[model samples]
Target chain A: MAEIVLEGITKRYPDGALAVQDFNLTIADGEFVILVGPSGCGKSTTLNMIAGLEDITEGTLRIDGQVVNDRAPKDRDIAMVFQSYALYPHMNVRDNMGFALRLAKADKAVINAKVEEAARILDLTQHLDRKPANLSGGQRQRVAMGRAIVRDPKAFLMDEPLSNLDAKLRVQMRTQIAALQRRLGTTTVYVTHDQVEAMTLGDRVVVMRGGVVQQVGTPQELYDEPVNLFVAGFIGSPGMNFLAATLEQGSLRTSLGDLPLEDRVRRRLEGRDVPRDLIVGIRPEDFEDAALVDERHTGHTCSATVDVRESVGSDVYVHFTEEGGPAGTAELAELAADSGRADTGMQGHRIVARLSPATRAAEGSPLDLWLDASRIHVFDPATGINLTHPER
Target chain B: MMSHRNRTLTGWGVVNVLVVLYALFPVWWIVALSFKDPSTLSDGNFVPRKWTWENYHGIFQTSEFTRALINSIGIAVIATTIAVVLGTMAAYAVARLRFPGKRLLIGMSLLIAMFPPISLVSPLFNIERVLGIFDTWVGLIIPYMTFSLPLAIYTLSAFFREIPWDLEKAAKVDGATPWQAFRLVIAPLAAPGVFTTGILVFIFCWNDFLFAISLTSTTAARTVPAAIAFFTGSSQFQQPTGSIAAAAVVITVPIVIFVLLFQRRIVAGLTAGAVKG
Candidate 1:
């Protein structure tokens, strides 16, 4: 219903804790925008600020080019679905859905018509007479959705609304919500902690951390070209493995062996002050199963022992420890849990490689890996910024 | 197979029944006395010498017990009305709004409740004398509120907290002002709590004896508790047995009916509103 723009939006509590700082994002009308981060990352705080639930510490929030920072939440023409549902327990589905219209003093026929239409949309027609206590978790969540839909507000704000449901229901509702948003074509701002939800739901996802926007782009942009190590690791599942080694004698070498970098990437890595702690990042799928003793392969490779291997029918996961590959200081904070990972390989200097079900390997066995050089992410070990080779 | 724990449980159950019997004995006596013949009111046996309706007749037909019961109802109704409105408004503010010195205000309300109210009777009498409203329904209603408001405000405030903030925000987004949200969303969700609070205030206001006795010198403001105490004169030491018994029955029956009607929600509301599971 409206395009929303957040210009230098920030939230600073009275105690001087900045929940969000200098946040800027542009969400087009009829687009689904997701704010995502770990707990205490201020993703939800930012969403609340946009909904008029929290005061903006600085900057302006505009919907349809109208500054709405000082406006009350109701005047902003938004509807929200809460994580807990928060349905009125005393009212039946009909009353719950129609409550806003009734308060607006809409005619009885208009309220009834709107409630019925929303119920039909949500498959809740038969539950019109039932109170929230009588409904199942998924049903109650739908009722919360119905309350918002009936209002036909300018924007829909959802704060992890599916988080409380069981895993299966969460998935089902996630799809339903995305589909509903598409059908309604309302400008929506959603805050979720789950990256998968963010990737799947967002037209433009804003990845936030430490009360700051890390990157704002389409999911494809983030997955393909993350601006920093944090975004690269946080946006992908079984994240990109970050390894440390050094550039020596115009080539990259680790205790494992010397690895060939693309001429273009090599030129970038060998630039001024050659990186002492060069971090090599490769996707799990990018690490192809190979034999260290293979006779033919010569171009691209990294080495780690096969610590543990798991199979999930469709694909096999080989988690291995990097012997002399890159391990020391190349990892991001989330990846730091894998430091010194040599024992169980569950959390340590380990790399998880996705293999075909046909490949087989046992735990604790040393194995060789071939990297798809085109997909490898090379970064400055200290700055964590990607060493992008425009030619490559 | 019975274990040692089962034997202990059975022993505890027996003791619990005995405790319950001790609690019910006085109530059972009052009901029995109300049905006994007026001539046998002083009889010794727990069972009346003859069960007759004559004593009930004496109270219902002769005395002003009915008038006194109506007067008590009127005063309790007025007191509960004033207390519920003020207490709920103040509690909502305390629970949801952030005003300066709110915690201190809440502390003062609790302090008012903690002091024994008997100390305030004379001061209240003086205030009433100055206001020229003593011995009236207004005087009785005023005194009862002091006992009811604190509990109502505290209970209602706790109830307000359990209503998830999302609901209010949703109401706000739906084009309702903050006041409208409180009236529509909060008031409905908190209705059960309000009922529970009302029942508590009603019971306290109805049973208060001191203020009802000292403040009102006439039948116009004398409540059931005060009226019951007047059944005997100091010099004669003679109790109006039938009238007092009949009045007790009238007073307790409504309470029992109320409990029966709202037993489930009231229990749930109390536990939910009080931070209990």
Candidate 2:
């Protein structure tokens, strides 16, 4: 119910390490914004600064058009749901939910009514008398949510609230949180390292890297058009496949084959001092089984040996090894290290294609994959900039 | 293999029985001696041939023993309350705050905990006498609280560190001021630690002997253990063994009862119930 604006926010530790620098964003009233990044990317730090749990070393944070740089967390009128649930172990569910109201010196009857309503909404009516230690993880998570809901604060801040739940329970609570936020129409800023959660829960996503904002856009916008190499690799599951390519006259030379650039891409490259060395970004969904694609629509095709095949009920993922070196860039290496994929440094890169379940691509056998040429993104290798970015 | 397992179980059973016997034999002998008739007191048998309540009645009737008992209870209670309150605050700060000389403070307390109490007796005796606080409850309570504060701080800090400090942040975000967060969230979580520390401090204050006898010249502030050393029989040449035995059994009853009632909570406090495990 409040519009939060961060202007040139910066956080510097005493050791001269910048945890978050020049972070600026304006979350519209009732908008759900997610700050997504890898570990140590400062998304949580930024959220902590907003929540007033951490001090803003620089810049002003305004809520509802009023600068709250010196305001304490309690004075800011915000509610935060911690990843660990952070429920009062000594208090039962009812008291946990009613803690804020009690602190605000609200009437006892009013507190009871609000807590009861929240319990009903969170399906925790039966657990009102149980201590947090006695409840299951999901129940404890709901109590954390109930605590926020009962307060009806100006804004909601969640730090990986569902990260501690089991996989199935996490999915269930994810939808519940999204629906609850929509119903309440409260401004929320959520932080998570999971891209899937960010893409699904956020109205707009802010991708951060090394204490800097990488891109700010909607999920589909980021998926379709990442501004650089890190966003391209970090935004999707089995992330976007990257390969080294060279820009040549009228065509692009890649390990797969020589393919003509799309008309829009070629136009952007014309009359520009673009670098010869480029990186090609292709999402898994951009590739399909050649057999399933119509001949007229198969504008581009690549042949590689399938290393593994996994069927996930709705679709099949064909993992393959193309005859090319992995895209060597500081961006990709940083992304790899962030994902902990850089542990075994000797292994070559993997390229995964999300093919239709009808695909018969077998392991250790050659598979022809149809590529959507228009969907591929081309980036300048030196600067990690998207050479064919639509806005540029 | 079956016989080997049987032999191992028997070996452990024997060791456990020996341990129980070793710990309880002295206590049982004191209780038996308390009940022995004065005529049969010289017989050093494990069991009394004839039992009587005369020694218990004799001690209870004497103003010296009664006054000392009152002093012991009052001094230990006051000392424990003060030490635990101060220790809780100090421990919380040590666990959660950042201040200079924190390590030095911890190291000094530890050094005090390991220091020999007898070494300070001579100095404390002269100081208390000059200060005119000797032969008073304040004299005994001061030393008890000072000596027990280190144990309180160490045990309570370990417990405080185990608490999920994020709950405090959550409280603040939930519209609580810093004081409210501590009173409602932090204090409740720390109750077990404080309670355990109180019992330990009380035990230390209650059982103190060197400073108690050395600092006090009369029954005005002498505790049970110190007063027992001064017990006298009805006649000038008679032994005070029966009365001493009776007082020892009487003093041990409260401690044993306290341990029995709070054994589970004390163990859990020591182990720290911070995480789910």
Each model's DockQ score:
0.41, 0.48
lDDT per residue for candidate 1 within A1-392, as digits (tens), equals: 89999999989999999899999888899999999877788988888888898999899999989999999887787888888776776678898889878877899999999999999999999999987777888898999899999988888999898888889988999999999999999999999988889999999998887898888889988888787777887888777777776766655565436656666566555544546667676778876667532432544665567878999888889987665545544336543442223334443466778877767567877666776665666777677677753322
lDDT by residue for model 2 over A182-246, one digit each (tens)? 99999999999999999999999999999999999999999988999999999999899998888
List lDDT for all candidates, in order: 0.79, 0.89
Candidate 2 CA-lDDT value: 0.89
Best by DockQ: 2
Model 1 clash tally, residue pairs: 5
Q: What would you estimate as the lDDT of candidate 1?
A: 0.79
**Model 1 chain A weakest 10-residue run by lDDT:** A335-344
Please report the candidate that would top TM-score against the real structure: 2
In model 2 chain A, the worst 10-residue window by lDDT is A295-304
